[model samples]
Target chain A: MTKFNFELTKEIELLRLVTVGSVDDGKSTLIGRLLVDTKGAFEDQLMAVRKKKGTVKVSSAAEIDLAMLTDGLSAEREQGITIDVAYRYFATPKRKFIMADCPGHEQYTRNMVTGSSTANAAIILIDARHGVLAQTKRHTHILGLLGIPHLIVAVNKMDLVDHDQATYEKIREEMKEYCAKQGVRDLICIPMSALTGDMVSVRGDNMDWYKGDTLLETLESMSVLDDLDEKPFRMPVQLLNRPQTADLPDYRGFMGTIASGTVKVGDELVVKPSGKISTVKEIVTFDGNLQEAFAPQSITIILNDEIDISRGDMLMHVGQEDSDSKFLTANVCWIGDEPLETRKKYLIKHAASEVKAMVSEVNFKTDIHTLAQDEADELAMNEIGRVTFKLQQPLNYDKYADNRTTGSFIVIDSFTNNTVGAGMIV
Target chain B: MSEHKLTQLKALEAESIHIIREVVAEFRNPVMLYSVGKDSSVLVHLARKAFYPAPFPFSLLHVDTGYKFKEMYDFRDAFCEEIGADLIVRKNEDAINKGMNPKEFGVARCCQALKTTGLLDALEEGGYDAAFGGARRDEEHSRAKERVFSMRDEFGQWDPKNQRPELWNIYNGRIHDGESVRVFPISNWTEMDIWSYIREEKIEIVPLYFAKERPMIERGNMLIPYYEENKDQLLEGEVPKMIMSRFRTLGCSPCTGAVRSDATNMDEIVIEAAAARRSERETRIIDHGSNSMEDKKKEGYF
Candidate 1:
């Protein structure tokens, strides 16, 4: 190892990804391999894993069980399963990565959703011996519904099947067919063995028939920047800043993150639900006033005119205002252990706005195994279903496919105050 | 990277700022827990940026164990004064009066009384509904699974198995009267990110992070810095030595170990950290035991 070229390293971008797999699919092993190969895992972490005194013994050809690296909880280690989503960080010369290691059990689908929600790409692991299992279909369906643009089907454990290219191709084709059905825009299939150190970071000789980029190369070369700035500008007001001080006694700036698109100093802006229009006087930051700002940048916006705006009011480009609706149809992923009861009041938190809401109807639950919509009265844990929500107050939102920031919301249990469900507008 | 896109550091900054502002908007009473370490320094810097024209909306709370490095205290007071921040210092007076020392009660119990119980008491006394902690997910295994908006029960205990499902950036900040939330603004940030951000932003951290010739004594294979309170802790044959070293982390002087290094400047520190093979918490003796942090967190420790 040498001193990092700080100049070149600082310019590299970040890539957020999630790993999807069922139990025994070597998901954690794959992540551990990436971290170790990239020097992301520290010596201490590896030492801890090697010396871990757990009762359950993981079967692996490697000296240490890579799966133990991610199964952090005592219960998980004891049970030899991942219970929740765990985030791991690694960096290559090309890009920095935040990989969400999602749990792979059938019942932990909600945990997978939680991890997959923010990912720009997903790595769906399939054991070569078991082709595309029902668990794989379930994971693929959930990832697609979460709007993950890129999907990499990693045909793991090729060594288990004697490094057979036919086996790899079979799983690849099955995954491709399934992903296409789910409308996955970008898909790549790779053959590798996490245990043998093959095709994960480096190209090993085992998969000579494979001609695609290694898993690392695909992640590094993949385009993470989207057309978010090209969309209509939206900034959800998170806080109304009022600094009543001697220098600036009457300063009132709306503080928020740019949800989508770009805004300049003189750009015209409108507050949603209020229909009041104003111009951006200044895009303020601690460093200085930025002349222009785009999506995901947190800044304070001062309007040229004094408008009545408070927290939860969204600033948007005029004529691109979202629809104001009190009733909405959405695809909901039930996360709470307690089943969702229809007509019971819950809280809907949408883009800085929290309002009382209730499930008006459960249209149908998606049978993940077959990807079929089944009629349902209520949703149980890990069940994905279409539901109608009646809100106490109207929300300004867009279709989830068009704009993820404005279109998504979480269902919070009013009594428990726990985030019970995650919903995306249809 | 595209010209229009923000750099990784800038994106991280924006995300942290967004989290800070969101907590301020949602929580009625929120306080930033400042420990005067490098992470806390970055956090304070972000909070300033979150509410630039106005001072940060909330006061900073420091749970003083009364056994921290004197230099940390000096830097904390000076930094707060420089930023014009409203700083609140809390201590477990009952435990201190009972003379609960690490040497007598052990590190875990001592930490429980001084840091954990002190923090819970302060939150209750201040009526804080939310607290911003500078915990990064990459620091520890258990924290890697922690939510950005972590909910705490009435007893301040963390339920690892029953955490709320945190999806995307839509954090649920709602809680009952006795419950509170621990918001980690930089949950996605890694140790390298923290040091890189510090170098890029020129953030002021305690001088202890930079290598200097300091008096120390070796205990349990760790270079423990000598403080006035640690004089009685010295063994019969052991003696303090002046060594060229710096801390990878800062906690209680007796528990935090210093590594032999000549990296006195920010650039050297960053380069050294990048090349170092060990984890950041390796130097902290309190974290030596497996699942110790998990156990502590379950008992209301941050």
Candidate 2:
């Protein structure tokens, strides 16, 4: 193979965003519009869709099946609804985007959690005509609980209201008030007719009274790197690459992806739970050596001296000690066929650490429509609640709001081996 | 490194390494499934780095489907020799000689008997408690909800809806006897991310990935190659054409297809792959027919 000198000139800024809304709120159409208006659609694909027979010609507006743009599955096309998360990719000169269009139905709440898990920003669509509905509040509340820093409430179907600003503001104010009550600080509201090209990418003159930036502009201007700087150094060991061959018999390295912060060669480090101290010897990638590594980067590390280190061990800055505690308060989204029962033993996975845990108590369950917390004994599907868990072994963690990488966990049912709930440490 | 605010690739790599280590620490007997593909190459590369200063901890298990490109074997052998790791090759010759043609028994059944069954036999014989694969979520819709530590029953069935919720980076690879977990260190990586990582890391892959001169036949818009005995399977319209082509994704020969391209190097291939109209799996003849991929996945085909 020829030696290729690959230089990354432009920093690849890929944003994962999910479009969420209530049923019949045109969330899919809004995404389809964003893709279409930006010229993200392929010529052959558009032409082929137009040629399809017996296609629904809704509103007689060019007869374009907007849902066809995103609903890629045959079943989804036949049913006219998103059954699963449909990921679509498009790139502008500024940045690349991977949009996850999640289902709007209430039963597919688990699908929504799957879609928005990795999203940096969420586009919660609300039909202007209907204002904020039950599903709308559920999605927004989910986004806020998921720790999505930025949100764009795309009040779609402005054409239905003759592009009325009053309807947009009424919904926007209601949404803003609801989000504030739910502790969502950063929110942007935009009125858009996803059917027609209005304030999606290009500025639509119909909404001249609106002073804020367009949807695309708002997304572009949003800070790509938020408070990731505040997160402490954390690298979860995934594998131990100990080549036992005759040529390099003494090779011992800790391989894993860095969850947050940075680690350099010769930096003092500490392994979690076991609390073993070590110094960074070398940082290795597939190509060659690396000087340092940070969050999201997968790399192998060789320590100066061999320490008893294995997988599920976390490597962090040595000076900063992590607390090994057995109990934590967390906000959980129950997603099991069986409702969460108190005192049930479940396996808890926090970062690279796994421990046996049981729900000690149910604090309160949040009302999906009202965002109100009511004391409850159990949680069902699509329900959000605060719960306390007692762990069999001490887990090293930070607050979920502080460091998302180390502060989240999943509750796995011991009997059926199903993931019952996802929790963010409070 | 100081100038760049850790790209998503870096984060993914770190996380994968972490997962790999965790699997090794938690599981008693673990083996990596090497398919001689880009994703597996990344997996091996990460494995080498995960336990640097020492040899790779686990052995590599390759389940030969009996209809692979000859070059893939050569590449696999060469890589094993370079890394000085043990390579375990298993094949279903009994089923093959029994005259089980994939075209007759259906793609899903063929995959189950040839790939999944063969893999199960090898795992049972080798007593492997866990197996690491290079499967990624971005590859398909069904894969999107897959957990990093995906547990399988004694029969190796993947219960999609019943998977453990994987939040943050915590992975639960726990399973009782007769059950094992399929660990994916790079579950979040997309096709673009894999290519970029391959380029950035300068990981060596099969030469078939780059465009080259080869005898190929056009079958339903896909470039099918005429290799060995399979040459006679071509119909009248399928004429051999010497086109510059490369396989975007690798699979069994009969199932995988090559795309016509001039991208002889990584840089050109990345651009072309990024702009490709169809998905990587769209060209696979086996998946093109009926609900084969999903069906095969349900029956424990990796």
For A1-426, candidate 2 gives per-residue lDDT tens digits of 343334542465668788888888877677767766655565434544553565533323245776555544544556666666666666665566777777888887877887787788999988888898888888888889889888999988898898898999999899889999978878999998887868887776788988888898887778777545446788777667666779867888776766668789999998887887879989987657889776677777889877898767888897866667889889999888888879988888777666799889999999887777898999987789999999998888878888777778888888876677889889
Report the lDDT tens digits of candidate 1 across residue range B1-302.
26569889999999999999889888899999999999999999999999987889899999999889999999999999999999999999999999988788888888989999999999999999999999999998889989999989999989887778888889888888899999999999989889989999999999999999998997765898876566887888889999999998999876788998899998899899888888889998788654388888888888
List the candidate 2 regions with Cα displacement exceeding 4 Å.
A1-10, A33-64, A72-86, A204-206, A235-256, A264-292, A298-319, A341-344, B1-4, B102-113, B116-129, B136-140, B144-147, B161-163, B227-231, B237-239
Model 2 agreement with the true structure over B166-231: per-residue lDDT tens digits: 544556666888998888888768787789888877899999999998999888677887775787
Please state the Cα-based DockQ of model 1 relative to the true two-chain complex. 0.77
Q: lDDT of each structure?
A: 0.88, 0.78
User: What's the residue-level lDDT of A215 in candidate 2?
Assistant: 90
How far in Å is the alpha carbon of A62 misplaced in model 2?
5.9
Q: Model 2 chain A, poorest ten-residue lDDT window?
A: A1-10
lDDT of 1: 0.88
- Candidate 1 residues lying further than 4 Å off, grouped into runs, are A1-4, A51-62, B219-221, B227-229
Candidate 1 lDDT, tens digit per residue, A261-368? 999999888898888999999999999999999988999999999989988899998888888988988998888879987887888999999998988999899987
TM-score of 2: 0.86
Model 1: how far is A398 from its true place, Å?
A: 1.3
